[model samples]
Target chain A: MSTDALTLDRLARMQTAVVLGYDPKFPAARRERFEDLGLLPDTTVQRLHTAPLGDPIAFSIRETVLCLRREDARRIFVKSVLP
Target chain B: MSAASLIAEEEKLATVALVGSPNCGKTTLFNAMTGMNQKVGNYPGVTVEEKDGLLVRGGRKARILDLPGLYGFSAMSPDEAIAREIIEGKSAFERRPDAVLFILDGSALHRSLGLLATVLQEGLPTAVALTMVDEITARGGRLDTLKLSRALGVPVFGVVGHKGTGVAEVLDAAVDAQSWPRPVVAAPLESAVARAAWSDTVLQECYREPKKENRLSRRIDEFVLHPVMGPVIFLLVMGFLFQAIFTWAGPLMDLMSGACSGFGAWIESWAPAGLPRDLVVHGVVEGVGGVLVFLPQIMILFFLINLLEAVGYMARAAFLADRLMGFVGLQGRSFVALLSCHACAVPGIMATRSIPSESDRLKTMLVAPFMVCSARLPVYTLLIAAFVPERAFWGPLGIQGLILFGLYLFGAVTAFTASWVLSKTLVKGSLLPFYMELPPYRWPTFRNVFLSMWHRAKIFVSRAGRVILPASMLLWVLLAFPRAQADPGVPAAVAQSRQLQQSFAGRIGRFVEPVFAPAGFDWRINIGVIASLAAREVVISTLAQIYGVESEDETGLVDMLKKARDPETGRPLMDFPTAMALIAFFVFALQCISTLAIMRRETETWKWPAFAFGYMGVMAWIAAVAAYQILSRLSV
Candidate 1:
């Protein structure tokens, strides 16, 4: 596969992943970017689980569990997955 | 070079901007690089904090501008916009940076490199500082910095910011690369997908990660984040926090109180019997002493909160709180602002800058002052200790401790209610989605925690000296002057009371007494309330002066208040019902002048602060009246 095609596939998969939360490190800007994506559905809710640090969060997107950092979530193009 | 020439050269140092994603340990790196040679100010026309430090490498000196953390150059929040403008050389006050220290988190390299791609496109002489390499390696991940640097066409240094590892090399590289050509990516990633792909490719080449999940962190998080148990654990943690603030700090508070009293006694004995004696004893020592006694509580509170934040539990707490905050029409992000208000409303209001929505920011600021800040600790401690029984409840919890917790909870509930009301009526906005990074839990360093506590203590004490000292002196003058003609037959206590009634503060208190009458406040309480408008803790010191006791002798004030009578009814002045009413009143009152001033500055208008003060004042009065009336009837 071409690099662009692979990139597009990876991006598509990421876009399907539910956004758990933004990394608190760069809170405001990352949050703004996440909101701009407009990926979260009204029915979507935060799923919390135990991690060494505290509760690592996940978002319920359909039935898929895509555990990723908030920064990663920001890179996923929401427009591709929307509607 | 001559000394004059060297000084001149240092004055005109080149600029280096340290740019990074938030939570990438950029600040720790900046602190390690700059050490004590740093100055903090605000960006031009913006309240966002600007930190600059002098980095002297060999004979070269550069001013390092620690720009606010940003994800990309796209201006979103004020922090990002300000940073973007500075980096782009569009800032009116700052010139373009001569070099850029681009920091990336080693554990999250793929995501971080996305930002690096943007930074590289800016064409500045950039160097990469990869942070958290230790954590990455501990988690069975490997990063080849050399290869990554070669690929990016920039120098990459592996550094642990907190441990000061590999920092000097990074600084040297940053300073020496001044003449280096502006960085150009071999292939620019134009679209978002391309950028993600580019970052992923780089990560694939340079990094490796262990396949297994982190068991320890996961096990701990399971219990901490349980839906039903999470809130229960949070409440228990918070309850213990407040209780410890009272329990652990009692001895230190007594010691501080004793020292103040001893110092005042020395001053009284040394000075001749006159206005100078009264002024030195009552004004400076007594006034500042009352505040100093509460320093231990304030320090302990800050220390605990800082530890919680450093341990990364605060973010989880915010995530848990997001749902409830949503019900109040507020973003979970406001939780940070409210938490900051626990220390001081000035910083709390300032922290609202992190909330992206203008309406959310304003609403958060409006209700933030209602949080029981450290300033209220002195008053609450005094009132609770004086009025409430000290008997233990259910083995360990003292009634005083529980009452203290109740006061804090009361303030929080009132703040949330106020936010909901204001959001519905004045500042209507949609609740922003909660997105908070739960940071890795780490043991909080003693150095960091101590430094934080010291900083807070210094601010509190300085405020006492600067604002409270002068206010106390003014109160002393108002209370001490217009000495009544003494009838040689009158007793000293009676004579003092009569003299106080004739004084300026006493006269003003009488004038305002009728307004507070329904709230069960007398002329003496009126004096304390009026004086406390400058700062909440002033009420404690003002009451000491009104009761003719040294402010440090809090026990003496309590004893005096116990015996004190209403001039008309001859009943005890500070009854249980009245004390409860006073506590309720203070829970809602916007008493801090500094909070008001900061609100004006943050909102850039007097309209919000004025509205906050008027509404809070009215709410406090009504609450106080209801508590007094209801409790008095119940007691009867």
Candidate 2:
């Protein structure tokens, strides 16, 4: 298969992906779901909050900077292409 | 693929392997699918735990293999190697799985994609189970399952394993999936940079999300993960936990103690006076009850720890302690294993499988038993209540409670010190960086908590039956045999003491008294100590039997012990210094046969367990002697 045909697979194969942020109202079960999924939120990524408004969260996963809304970031599947 | 071809594939693929990264809700999903139909064993030639369960759906049955969580196909540790071998059809135990259920975390797609890619590359008939979908949508994010499925050229089903949401649909799709095309050999990404570039491209195309931050989690982490306040909070939490273990379990422990005594009295009343009656009433009932009384404490400890784990504060505690652990040349991950030792060292040692480094795992295993496990609770409770006064230190903290807390603290300190020494001498290694994900905090489900507590209680009770029962019977034989002639003038307690001294255990205790003399132990204490080697709590039962007290009457035994005098000096046998020395000894002693046997099993060798026994034995003797000498001098 061409690399394009394997684009999704290749992304899945990346060693690291940044977690941008998560929703404040994120259910404990859902957070536990992530833990169950082996993505330990605290240990896996560094969370950085912006001053005054920590609305958009930033996390570095292997040099990838992901900026996502708190609500939408709970289940982020990012694979950064940066070397 | 045509339906006929799909049918052929499904026929050959009778087994489904649930593969995912560690903590990916894979086990939970497996439980949902298999329910109670699972068999757990060790893989051939390795101690890695293997779980196999039956997956029954639509009148069709397939075997499901729950492999240990793996990061990739490249196996680094024994656990990962087992996972890799089974996935590659190289396992001696079973053939390659027919289909792969690739579990992916819906919330953290980027991290999981790498493993998913590897699974797809293997060319198995694979289906994606998008777990944590509820968490995703709950966070105001939606996953385009169909779009993502079409994009990846495979079936993707969203599932919430615990809630049974969309799980049946996922299982149906997985069972019906046709053979997937194997990836043609392509030039592998030669550098880390190339791999990252590839992952970036694939994620950008398939996954869609709203730009947002998790503000609530951040606000909580600010305090929870704070440096100074974090440790303070952790200490306060632990202090409360230990206090609760004592105070909360008091009523239950008392009830168990009372019930055992009543049962023993009832048995004694009906049974004829002979070896059989003595064995049934004193040996079996007393031994089992002595251990059973501590069951409430064990259950409560596990229940509280599990609640904390469910709440996700354990990870943060580990994070804060990482630096201190590093200073001791151990990983922060060892914190959980050590914490778990409070309930039982066996599980705590088993939990070391998560420590990737070999040296670190071994060190953690060695020190785990040093933590004051529930097995020691009975001994501590007995000793502290007898020796320490009931007066309050500051407000509600009783002196006895403070001493109990001190013993726990002493265990933890000694364990850390031992770890440092071992890291420096025996198992030298650099500290590995801590990489752990702190799950979002939530309320613990009552079902989950209750089940966990129930499982621990079952294990403790079963062990009492399996290991303690036989050992108790053996001890009874040793103490009851070589029957002494009954003299009318001899008091019953004195005759029983004479009978015990002439028995095999008594002989052994006498033979060892010279060695134990420095620690203030006489022949009777020596016999209790020897019997305790079978299990620590047996010391209490053995002492009761030696003193001729009814097996159920603990207070009577305490009164006897208080009046016990050394024939040579006429001083009380259990003086304040002697009690302190005995407490010190139990604190450091490796007296649990079960713990040693488990260590042997986990390490796959007798050498380490033997070493643990030898070192701890020596340490216990020295600590006991020093405690006795120092305290005696102060009393004089």
Candidate 3:
């Protein structure tokens, strides 16, 4: 598969940087709050687990389990060990 | 693990404590279980409060305690301390729950599961209530509910608490399920290496991520959190909320005022002539009516706040304000509590319970009185009507409402500065770091919205009955007594009323007039100030009583206020500048008894409230004096 087409599960295990900022899908309010809570781009986060329905994805950053809408997750770039 | 030893001793009707991170729909589930059966109050020593309720789930009725939301249960913060104590049955929180409803957002299972995993090792009989199922589904994620349930060795139920979807089913299953056969409890991690080793394995078995485009939230957060535009958006949103409140509540305010005045007039005809009629019309009706008029304003504010909180915008506001608020040595959460003081300070001070830090809580309670409360409305209205020209600024901004808004802004600024000064001078401390969980945005339930509004209205009316009525009656006695003796040289009407000028109130104000001379306040204004200490709304009623008006609700208050003549110049009493001075005085003054009472109770110290009143009183007088001097000089 192309690098851009990498599976989310693979992306979860890898750590990379995403160029863009807040995702477009969820409300602006949530993203702003996440940023205030120090969950911003280029910050290293371990992608933990997604719920069965998978809207709010959990990531472990600075030992805090920060939950973000999936749309927010895609905007976030994670470097991959496999890549 | 002896889990069986711990469980076989569990009592039926055992308490179930629902604990989780904030914004996890925990409150919604609590409400679903308990209905109108929750009590809100402060916890011991610390202000971050507790909410308690009883739930009848399954075949047995168990006490359900809703603990303050914690990011984790590691016993670090006061909130976490309470959660841990309850779980360990070490705290006086009515003993440990028989089981725990370890509720988490189904949308963020892994992060939530991190906490859940900790709870599982606690060896407590626990079940998971997976909420926000629909929101998760919409995001193209799915949960293996049965598989996860089996792996965790506990029952898990899917619930949408707001919609009442699958709530009863989940609740029934949760309360009915007994302790499972005792299983091995994980050993406590010995070191950093051990913890790292354990958490990795826990994540592997139960967690998954969805494969999709994370495009939506990213785009929105970009514009909203933009350094330049974010604060602007916040202000515009707040401005719109205020404008909507004023426009929406205007008609209701007018209707209520009219009905009150009509009722007062009708009662006047039935009351005996002289003191009885004056007391009924001027003291009771006008005093009470003044407070009632602000009902719509209070209601509108409450509704808007509840809506904001429900829709989850409140958390976002806190996020935006966090940095600015830290400068004043307060958590961003304290802003909402202090803002609510504009409606009434009592509840505002009570709301300080939500601020986890004791120093932040005390400081918030102390400065809350400085916020111009709804009680100050009557004073502002009377003065504005008497003197302010109704001309609009730039043809759109109401000069009157703008003035009112300016006073509100002044109060807010003063409150922040005062807190900063207090933190530096007396309550010395570095600002505490804040951690808050921002919940997902959701539609507000109409039930919660209406219920909150109703609660506020009830508090308003009850206060009117308990405090306002007695205070107005006392003012009535002071105004009405000491019947004039006949003087041969004077006409009967003149002779009968001369005693009022000689009576205690008259003598008192005259004695104090020199003190307020610099502030441009005459004896009448001084007397009005004295009467307002009982309740600020009583000032207008007292003024109407002193003016010898029998019916003061509508015609009496307005006419007498217009007729008031300045003792210094013998001109119309309330000139534009003097009216401006009066508004400024009330804007800064700590006049409300209710506010002081709440402050004293919250702080558990009479010294704080007394000191607050002294400082604000001095500030008010100086500000008013300076304003008057400037206006008088410019006029000359």
**All models, DockQ values?**
0.10, 0.04, 0.05
Instruction: Please give the clash total of every predicted structure, in order.
Output: 10, 35, 28
How high is each candidate's interface RMSD, in Å?
8.3, 12.5, 13.1
Q: Candidate 1 at B546: error in angstroms?
A: 5.6
Local distance difference test, candidate 1? 0.69
TM-score of chain B of each: 0.80, 0.82, 0.78
lDDT of 2 by residue, B404-472 (tens): 999999999999999999988999763321245555555455555666566556645663346556666
Residues A1-83 of candidate 2 have per-residue lDDT tens digits of 22233111123222334432233454544443333233333223434422112223334342122323344353443334344
Ranking of candidates on TM-score, top first: 2, 1, 3
Each candidate structure's TM-score, on Cα atoms with residue i matched to residue i, is 0.76, 0.76, 0.73
Best by lDDT: 1
| lDDT, candidates in the order shown | 0.69, 0.68, 0.65
lDDT per residue for candidate 3 within B1-636, as digits (tens), equals 122112324544556788776767787888788666555444644444566655565456555677777644432556667787877778874567677888976755545665665566677777888888777666666666666666667777788877989788756755554563223446664332343345446545654444542334434544554456656776776776656555666688789889989998898868777766877787888768756765776677777777878876665566666556767877666877787677667667766655667778888887888788767877888777766667788668978778878878888898999999988888765222334444556777777777656656665556334555565567656655665565788654444345556666667878988888877877777777876876787777666555545554765676777786654578765566666777778877888765665565556567888888898898889988988878877852
Give one digit per residue, the lDDT tens place, for model 1 in B1-636.
223223325676667789987767787777666655665545545556677777777877676778888766543667777788878888875678888889887655655776788788889988889988887777677889988887788888999866778988887875675765578787776644466667767767787765544445556667787767777887787667656665677788889989998999987877788777877787778878855765776677677777777676766666666656766767655776676577667656755765656688888999998999878988888888888878998789888898898888988898899899997898986333334555566666555566656655665566334655565567668877778787889666667767777888789999988889998999888878877876788787666555555436778767766676766778777888898888888988998766775676666667998999999999999999998999889953
- Candidate 3 local Cα displacement, residue B69, angstroms: 0.5
